[model samples]
Target: MSLAIDFYDETNTITEEQLNMLLELVNHAAIEEGVDAGSELSIMFVDNDRITEINREYRGKDQATDVISFALDDEEEGEVPLNLGEEVPHLLGEIVISVQKITEQSLEYAHSFDRELGFLTVHGFLHLLGYDHMTEEDEVEMFGKQKVYLEQYGLTR
Candidate 1:
């Protein structure tokens, strides 16, 4: 019963402390959200160019976004399970974050880099848990949750 995270830094910019802090924050959020303990996810840090390419290919947006999430088991309620019998870790999905965007947004928002990164990381994680911000109500719910989670993690602006 544990949360397994596969972290990859394509831009080679994220520090060890940042990674550890993000991991702690994610773990806390996962527990609070009641996610299965045996769940897994990946977080990849990339440059602006890489993220822009990914956004264009996958999301049809030719711009650099702060974070993008791909959920593996995004089945709706009452949907059939993909795995059978064995208790394997649920692969939630991958979170792709743009390091350049983090830096840019930190400056733009007049917030610390840690605060920006924490916000984006949790934002992407919530998406993996089936949270979306397409509608006004949905945005309120999702963004509110993000604020609570960030504040709880002591990453407040």
Candidate 2:
């Protein structure tokens, strides 16, 4: 059992090795969160401009944030699409990350690029699993889980 991750890169800020690490990080996030291994996810790396456009179009935000997660499992919200039955894969969601934010935040936070990227990846994945930071309690829980994944993957700052 393994996650079917579809990673797409729209920027060349990271190397292939970085992408491999991201894949492993996401897989670990799913497993640690008790998500089935056969689940699927999609990640897209884009520049600041692209992310800004997405933010504006989706969340009514005019700024370019770090990452955005669009969960596809919200049946109550009518966001999930009806499939052709059991044969269809269990798609978790889509995560869009901005390479520019990764670099800038890494420098601002005094952490390595890898660490920042790992944090963003885990944060995004957790969102797909219904984790959020809208409250202080939820922030602790969500961020704590993210730290665990990053530390286990040697991405600590």
Candidate 3:
């Protein structure tokens, strides 16, 4: 599949190689979920303040979140091939991640920043693909899938 990923950040903490790895992980997850070719997704990295503002505006939460995803397609609609309907590409959705949270969680979890970031990236990507953790069973399934994806990418902590 051809994927277009855009990474935006207020600071240059994440290296180019790290971003590339994230893209690879997300794409791998997409393929596993049977996403068609020419899919596109965007990831934005920001500070705690920015993510907190977005969390408040979108989710009505006043706290900073590690990551948030906005998906364009509805999963219930079935696995239809994404059609751009024009020369434009199909926009899967956007994922916003808090780099500050990644740093903090890395320290708290006693893992490298790369692993934490990779986990967050895959978590957000799964959300975009219509996976959720609203119930215990759902949480188990979703988190299990996330672990599998991260492990496949060699991002185990």
Candidate 4:
């Protein structure tokens, strides 16, 4: 999938297998949505304090957030093919995740840490692909697609 993941924090809570699973999950979603295989995406993991600062700075929210996506492509222009005429990979965007929040939410939702992390990863990936939940209808559609994709990837909780 040409996905590049960078862990911002030194904790290293995510294993290589888990990271591969996430990449495959997102790659499957992108393929199903007709995105090119050469598309490049990045996922970054950070601790609570770091994510809290990011939330405040980027989202104007003082609290910690589970995940944040910075999409590089404009959806309004349609799905752009990655690596079309260039040797370099297309920069899809960055997804920043708070490992602290994932742990907390796993407990809150009564699910395993892997499940929560996988869910959050999928959610963040979707956001990078231009999915949003600004309205009730949008929420339904986005969340439904998330559920479908997760289940298809065997990440169901």
Candidate 5:
């Protein structure tokens, strides 16, 4: 499968190794989740202020969040038309992460920065794949999946 990832580091604080690691993690996630071959997604790294603005604007929460995902194909089955016999990239939408939050959460949760970053990355990826933790049952399922992915990917706390 060909999964194109567009990465933007607005904070410019992430290292090359960290970026590459996340890219690999994302690719692994796509494979594990059976994503389409021609799928495309973007991951943007921002600061607390930027994420706060985004959270306020999009989610109506005036606080910085660890991650926010916008899925392009989140509409209902009948809402969006199907691609008929055409070879085109399926847009998976974007995952915006707060670099500052990563650091803070890692410390707060007593885990390595890599672990927290990987968790957030996979969490956002799951959202792009239409997973949500809205209800108790949904939260169990989604969080369980996240733990499994993180453990399998060796991003343990």
Candidate 6:
């Protein structure tokens, strides 16, 4: 499948090789999820302040989250308008990740930075694929799938 992952490192904490690996892992996630090729999504790395603002504005929560996803393929009321009659979609939505929080979480959870990053990336990508964790069952399914992808990517806690 053709998946374009625009990885923006605003924090500049990660190297080019690391970024490449992250992008590749995202592609692996898409393939695992059975997403059609040619889907495009954006992943932005930012600091806590930026993420806090986004969290407040979009999700109505005034706090800094590790990651936030905006799904763009839905035609539901109040959501983004769907692309009609288009073979390739321009947007599947965007994922905003907080670099500082990632490091903190990595340390807090006693895992490698790559592992935390992989978890967040996989979690966010799943959201883009129409997966949600509003309930216990959903959370189990989503987390289970995420764990498998991480294992395949060699990112273990």
lDDT of 2 at 154: 88
RMSD of 3: 2.6
User: What digit string (tens of lDDT, one per residue) describes model 6 on residues 86-129?
Assistant: 77566789999998998999999999988898899889989988
Model 3 weakest lDDT span, ten residues long: 75-84
Expressed as tens digits, the lDDT of each residue in 1-157 for candidate 2 is 5789888888866788998998888888777878986889999999999999999999999999999999988778656667788868888999999999999999999999989898998999999999999999999999999998999988999
lDDT tens per residue, model 3, 36-135 = 6687888999999999999999999999989999997765656767575777776789999999999999999999999999999988988888889999
For residue 113, give model 5's deviation from the true position in Å.
Answer: 0.6
Backbone clashes (count) for model 2: 0
Put down candidate 1 lDDT per residue, 109-133, tens digits, no spaces. 9999999999999999999999999
Q: Is candidate 3 or candidate 6 better by TM-score?
A: 6
User: Which predicted model would earn the best TM-score?
Assistant: 1
Name the runs in model 3 displaced over 4 angstroms.
75-88
Question: Could you give me the TM-score of model 3 versus the true structure?
Answer: 0.90
lDDT, model 3, position 16: 87
Sequence-dependent TM-score of model 1? 0.95
lDDT of 2 at 71: 96
Task: List candidate 5 segments past 4 Å from native.
Answer: 80-85
Go through the candidates in order and give each one's C-alpha lDDT: 0.93, 0.90, 0.88, 0.81, 0.91, 0.87
In the order shown, the candidates' Cα RMSDs to the true structure are 1.4, 2.1, 2.6, 3.0, 1.3, 2.4
Q: Name the candidate that leads on lDDT.
A: 1
Return the clash pairs for model 1, or none. none
- Model 6 bad stretches (over 4 Å): 77-87
The positional error of residue 42 in candidate 1, measured at the CA in angstroms, is 0.1
Ranking by lDDT: 1, 5, 2, 3, 6, 4
